[model samples]
Target: MRGEGSAASAAGGISGGDGGASGTVPPPRGGSRRGGSRRGGGPANRRGRRRVLRWVASVLSLLILGTGAAGYLYYRHLNGSIQTDALNLGETKLGGSKPNAFGQTPLNILIIGSDARNDAANQALGGATETFDGPPLADVQMLLHLSADRSNMSVVSMPRDTMLMMPKCTEANGTVHEASKGLVQTNESLSRGGPGCTVAAWTELTKIPIDHFMMIDFKGVVSMADAIGGVPVCVEQNVHSRTRDGKGSGLKLPAGTTNIQGEQALQWLRTRYGFEDGTDIGRTHAQHQYMNSMAREFRKNAKLTNPVKLNSLAQAAIEAMVVDPGLNKIDKLFDLSMELKKVPPGRITMTTMPWIYSTRPGLDGRVEPKAGEAEDLFRMVREDIALDGQGSGTPASAGSSPAPSASAPGTAGTAQSAPPAATAAAPAKIAVSVRNATGGKDGAQAKAKGRATEVATLLAGKGFTKAVADTQTGAEDTTVVRFATDRQAADAAALATALGLPASSVEKSGEVPGIVLYVGKDWRTGDAPPAPAPAPTKAPDSAHPLNGDNDKACMAIQPGFTW
Candidate 1:
C-alpha cells in the first residue's frame, strides 16, 4: 500500500489502457479536421480521411495491446528465473532490528560476480576452451547494505586479494571440501560451491549474516545497459585498457560526461590498468559510479514510460540475475522492487572496505583490512547505523543498542568457546606486533604496541596459549592484525571478540607468517605490557603483483558465471 501510487501507475501503463488518472482523453476521430466544414469536403476526401484515421487507430490499438502482452510475458519470465532450490532460509542472516533514521529495516545483500565458465554460454563469453580450466572465479564481490528505513544504501566492495579464512564449501556439482584441509582464494569459493559457499565464507569471515544475494554476469549487464540506452559516466581522466583475451576492449573517453553502452559499459567496469591503483578496488568505485549514474538516468528518462522499454529492461535484468531461492518468488521481487523504487540515487552511498597491501612469504601480495575495521563495519550494519568516513564506529559512543548475537558460541554475549567444528583448526604459535599507523613525533608507535600486546595477552587468555606480543612498526595511518596462517587468523577473530575488541580492529594477513598486531591511533592500551618494534620486511616493491592477465580473464568471465 505504501507504494500503491507508483506501482498502480506503472501497472496501468502496461495494461494498454488509460487509468484516467492523467485526465486526458483520446481525441475524437476526424472531429478537429472536419469541424463545421464537413459539407465542404468531397465524398472521396472524406472517405480517405476516415480510412486513414481508422488505420491509425487500428495501429495504435495494436501497439498498446502488443505492449501489454509483452509486459505479461516479461513478468512471467522473471518469475521463472527465480531459483527456489537455491534459497537458504536457514542460512540467511539479518542485521540487528534497530531502525535507521527513516525507521526502515536495513538489509545487506552479497552481490557475487562469478568467473565460472562451466556453462556453454558463459564459456563462449570468455572464449574458453574445453581443457578443464575450472569454473570462473568470483572476481567481483560487493556487499550492498541498505538502511533499515530503505532511505540510504551503501555498496562496499571487498577486494578478492584479501586474505581470510575460507569456509569449507559444497559445490553445486556435489563436491565437498573441508575448510581446514585446503588454502583457498577468496574468489575461488564461487567456482567451487556457487554463491552459497561464497555466502558461507563471508559469514564466517565477517560474522555478519547476509539476507539476500543477486548475481549478474557480462551479457546481462551489456543487454541491460543497452536496453536502457546508455548510462552516462564522468571520468576524471582518459582511460584505455584491453580485455584479458588480448582483444581491443580499450576504453577511450575524455575527461567529461560520456554515454557508454554495450561492450563499452563492460569495458569501463573492467578497465583496471588505466584506473587508480589498478586494483579491483579501483574498478569497484567505477562500477559504483556507473550504477549511480544509471539509477539517475533511469529516473529521469520518460522513455521508460513506454511499456515496451520497461518490459525489456525488466526482462533483461531478471534473465541476467541469479537470486537466492527465497528471492525468486514474484511476490518477493515485487516487494523488493517496490522498496528499491522508494530510495533515490543520491541516498545511496558506495565505499570499499578499507584495506592495506601486505606481502605473504610464500603467497603473493594480498590486500588486508585494517584491524577491527571490518568488524566495526559489520556492527554498524547490525545496528542499522551509518559508518563514519573512515568506516569506524564505536558501539557505545554511537549511542545505538547492540544487535542480537548468533546463538552459536563465540558470537556476541555468547559463552566464550572455540569456533564451530567446521571452522575450528589447530591453533598456531605466533607472535603479534602492534604499531601506530598514524604518524606522530611522540611515543605513539610504542603506545600502539602496548595495545597490541594487550590484545595478544587477551588472545592468550582465550585459549590461544602461544600468543605473544611483539614490537611496533612505523606503518602509516592504518591499524591491522596480521596472522601467520588461516587457522591462527580464525583463532584471532574469536579472541578479539572475547576480549571485547571491535571486529573492525581485527585483521588477518597471510604475509607476516606470524601474528602481528598493528594498532591505529584510535586504539588505546589497557593493562598489558608494551611490545617491541616489529622487524620490517625486505624492499616492498619487490613483492609479486597479481597476475594481471589472469585477473583480466577473471574479470571478463565474472558476469556470465554469476548469472
Candidate 2:
C-alpha cells in the first residue's frame, strides 16, 4: 500500500486507492528484505509486516474518504447560500423558443446589476447612506445569449435611462404592480418585484424567451471581480473621472493596459465622466470593454481548472447572487458555465442597443430605443443569429409573399421572386387592411409617420372604398398584396395594380382576412415601391459591437477629465 512508506509519505499519499501515487507505493523493488532488520528473519516477521502494510492502507483510505465527505458538505453549503425566485413574474406568461433543425435551442440569461445599498458592504461600495433601504434601480442590464450550437455568444446592454411600458408584475410577497399607462423608466421595473420583474419587462419588449436570470449588487460586483483575479483595461489617455465636488465614478487610470479588479474594476465600468462624450452611452461602451477583456483573460489564464480559484468564484457568486429557480443549484450552474466555456473568446460580441434621447414629457434626460435599429438588434437575438458575423444565420425577411414577416416591424425587406403581373379586377367594394412596415434598417430617415393611413386614404381615392388603416406593424421590405381566399385573388391584384406594385407582390395566404395591403418599407413615401436590395444580416452600425478578442482597443478619454 502507498502508506507503507515513511510517515511523511503516508500523510501525502492518502488521496485514493486507484493506482494513484497516493493509492499504492511498491515495496522497495521486491518483497521486504529478509534479515535486513535485526528482528526480521522468516514468515512470522513477514506476516507481521504485511499486517502493518494493510493497516496503513486502511487508515489512508479512511482519511481520503473523510476529506471527500467534507468537500461534499461544503458543496451543500454553497447551494444553501444561493437564493431563488420565479423566472418570470408577469401574469401574462411569455412563450419559449422553438428548437432549431438539429433539436438545439439557445439559452438567454439576463444579468442585472442593482444599485442597492441595503447592507454594510453594499453601502460602502455605493456610498449612499441616505438612499439605503430605498427601492433599487437596475443600473446595468445585459442579456447574454448562448447560440444553439454553443459556438458563439452575444450580449445586449440596455441603458438604465430607457423608457418603455413595463408589463404587470407580482412579487413573491403578493404585491402587484400594474402595467404602466404611460412610458416609465426601464430601471424602475426592478423596484416592482425584484429581478424577475426586470426579466419580465425584457421578455415582453424583446419577445426573446429568457431561460434564467442572475442579479447582483454593488458589493457583489466587487467580490466577483476580486475572485476573477483581474481584467486588463486600456484608456486612450491618463484620466480621472471625479469633479471638484467628488461627483463621479472616481476612476483614475493611466493611458495603457492595466490589470484591475475589485474596486478599480467597478470604477472602470462606471466611469462615464472620464470617457468620450461623458454620457451613459459612453459608460455602456466602457462596460463592454471590461466584460470582453475579462472573458478573454479568464480563459487565457485557465483558472477554471484550479481548485482554489474555482472555489473563490463559487463562494463569491453564492454570497452575492439571487438567481432563477432553474439555476438555484450548484451543479446546474456548473453545467451552464460549461456551455459558455465551449464558446471561444473571438465569437463573443457585446453591443449597446441603438438609442436616441427621448422627447417624451419628464423624460428629456432619458433615452428611447431608436426605432429601426433597435428592433433589428432584437431581431437577431430572437432569431438566434450570431452577432459576431461569423455565422450565416438570417432572419425571415419581413417582405416575403402574403405571409407575415417573422421579424419586428419596420425592418427592411427585399422583393420576393414570384409570378408575372396578373390582370386586375375592379377595385370597387374590396376591403383592404393597410399596414405600415417602413420600420427597420439603420436608415437616415425615420419611419414614415402616416404611411398606413396615407395608403388607406390612397385606396379610398381609388375605387377600393373599404380600405382601413391599423396600428399593426410589418417588417416587409417590399410592398405586397395578400388575399385570403380564391375569390379575393383578383381583388388583391386590383389593389396592387392601383398602388403601381408589380404582380409578383400579390400572394395568396390562408391566414389573412379578406385582402390586406402591406405598405412595406420600400413604399414609405412613394406612390410606387422602389426596387430593393437584399435584406441585411449585420447589426446596425450604431450597435458598436466589441469582440472579446480585441485587446488592442482602448477607451477614448475626454479632454476635460485628464488628470
Candidate 3:
C-alpha cells in the first residue's frame, strides 16, 4: 500500500470482466428462476446448475480471480468499466511460453493490489484521508501460475516491504523512470510509472514471462467481499489489532472460528498487529489464510448457483480493476475463467516469497529474498513443477537441479526429452553472459574473486568466444545456465553440458539477453560445475505453503494483542 510507505497487502483473487445477470449477459442455459420453469429439477437444469456453479467457483477462485470474470452480460457497459493499459512497459519483452507435449501452455498473471486514494470511496477504504489524490502504490503483489495441464495452480506473494533492484521502465506517455540507484522497497516501484513498471520489476526479479496484470485498490476489496458472503476463519485467542495511539487495524474478534464479510472481512486480512508479530511478513501469512479459506467456503456455498449473485460480484470487480489490454474483452476473460475452473481447490498452492531482513544498516528493516530456497521455488514454477510436490517431477525433497537427464529445452518437468542432439549455433557466434554468483551461503562472502572472467575465459578457450563476464555479483547456492528463448535452449544446454552441469541446472529465463552461466559457490574453483544435487521432495517450511483444501488452518494471535 505504501499509502504511508505502508501496505495492507489486501486480500487478492483473480479479477473478473463482466456484469450481473440483470444486465445484458444471458442467464446460464437449462436453469431458470423457480417460478419461470415448469420442470424444476430436469436433467438440463441440473447440468446447468453444476455448470453455473463451477463458473462461480472459478471467479471467486481466490481473492482476485473470482471477482474478475463474472460481468460480461452487461456487454458494452461492463466492457467500459474495465480500464486497459499497456501490458509490459519494460524495454525488452520476453517471448511466449512454450507449449507442453500436448500443446498446452501454462498461464501467468500478476495480481496487483494498489493503495490509491483518488476517489472518495478509495480514500475512505484506505484511511489517511488527508493523503487524497496521491500516487498509487502497489502494496500487494502476487504471481498466479496456472499449470500447462490446468490441473494445478501456484500463487507466490512478494511482501510489500521487500527490497530489490527496480528495473528501468518507460511509461506509455513517454516518461522515463531510470532504474533505481540501488535496491528499493518493492512497493515504491509502482510510482516509477504504472503497474507495467511493477510488472517489469517482477519479470526482472523472477525471470518469468508475465502474460497479463490485474490491479485493484482498497475499495475494490471492500466491494467484492460482500459478494463472497461470509468466509469462515479461526483464531487461537480473542485479539484486537489496536494500539494506544491509534496505530493498528482496529479489528477485534473473539477466539475460535467465525464467519466474516464486508469491511470486517477486509479488516480480517488487513490486521497485522493482532494476527502475528506485527510485521508485513506476518500479514502475508494472514492473507494466505483468508484466501485459502475463501476458496473452500466458495466451493461449498449453495448461493454460488445463483447467476445473479455471480454477475453482480463479477461486474463490481472488473469495474474496479485496471488490466492489461490482453484481458480487456469479455470472451477472453470467460476463457481465462474456464481454465481456472479446471484446477480444483486441492491442487492449488499458495506461498509467500521466503525473505530475511536486509542486512544493510539503513535498510535493515526492509526485507530481501531468502537465498537458495527462493531460487528453488521460482525454478519449480518456471518448469511448471507444482510446489505442492505432486505429479510428473521428481520428489520435491532437497534441491532443484536434477542430475543430467535429457537434452530438451527446460520445461514441463516430465517432458524434458528433446531431440537426440539439440542443435546450437556455432560456439563463436553465441553470446553468453557469464556472471559470478559465488558464495553468500551461511554468511559466507563472495570468496571466488574474478570467477566470472575466469569462466568466461574458459568458455572462450572452448571456442565460445562471445562469452562475456558481468561486473555485478550475486549469490547462488549452485551453478546454473539460464537462457531467454526456446531457440536459445539448445545453446544454453550446450553450455551447461560443456561445463559438465546437469540438465536440470539449465533453465529458461525471460530477463536474460541470451545465455547466462552463473559460476556459483558450487563451481568456485573447478573447470566444471558440480554434479546436480538431489531434488526437493517437499516445499520448505520457510515458504509457508497453504493448500486450498486445508480447512484446519488457524491464525495465532500475537501475545500483546490477544485477550
Best by lDDT: 3
Better of 1 and 3 by TM-score: 3
- Per-residue lDDT, model 3, residue 256, is 87
> Runs in model 2 with CA error above 4 Å?
1-76, 172-174, 304-309, 392-535
Rank the candidate models, highest TM-score first.
Answer: 3, 2, 1
Residue by residue across 1-563, what tens digits does model 3's lDDT show?
31111233232111110111222212221112111221222321221111111111223533334333443354435666778877777754554444554445677888887766677665444444334555666677888888776778898988776788887888988898887777777877778889899898888777677787777654445556677778888888997665433334546678888888765665666555556555556666777777778877766764454556556666666666787888886555656765676677898888988888667765645678898888677767767788898854332235543332221112223434222445888888989988888884443764588899999999999999999998876667778787888788888878877878766566665557778887788788877776655656556778999998888888887666664
lDDT of 2: 0.62
| Tens-digit per-residue lDDT, 153-211, candidate 2 | 88898876678888888887889889888777787888888888899899767767787
User: Residue 78, candidate 3: how far off, in angstroms?
Assistant: 2.2
Q: What overall lDDT goes with each candidate model?
A: 0.46, 0.62, 0.64
2 against 3, candidate with superior lDDT: 3
Q: TM-score for model 2?
A: 0.63
**Model 3 stretches astray by more than 4 angstroms:** 1-77, 91-94, 305-309, 392-525
**Candidate 3 structure, TM-score to reference:** 0.73
lDDT of 1 by residue, 1-563 (tens): 11111333222211111101111211111111111211112331111111111111111111222223335444655577644324221221222232323223446667776544445554444432432265545556777665554455555667666666665665556667556443345766665467777777776666555777766554334345455477677665554432232222245565567787655665565544344543345555566566666566656663344566656556655555677765665545555554455455555555566666545453344566665555555555555554322221221225554332222111212322222322534444434454444343234454443554566666676566666655545443434455555566565555454445544444443246555565555445453323323322211112111211111211222111111
How many steric overlaps does candidate 2 have? 6
Comparing 1 and 2 on lDDT, the stronger one: 2
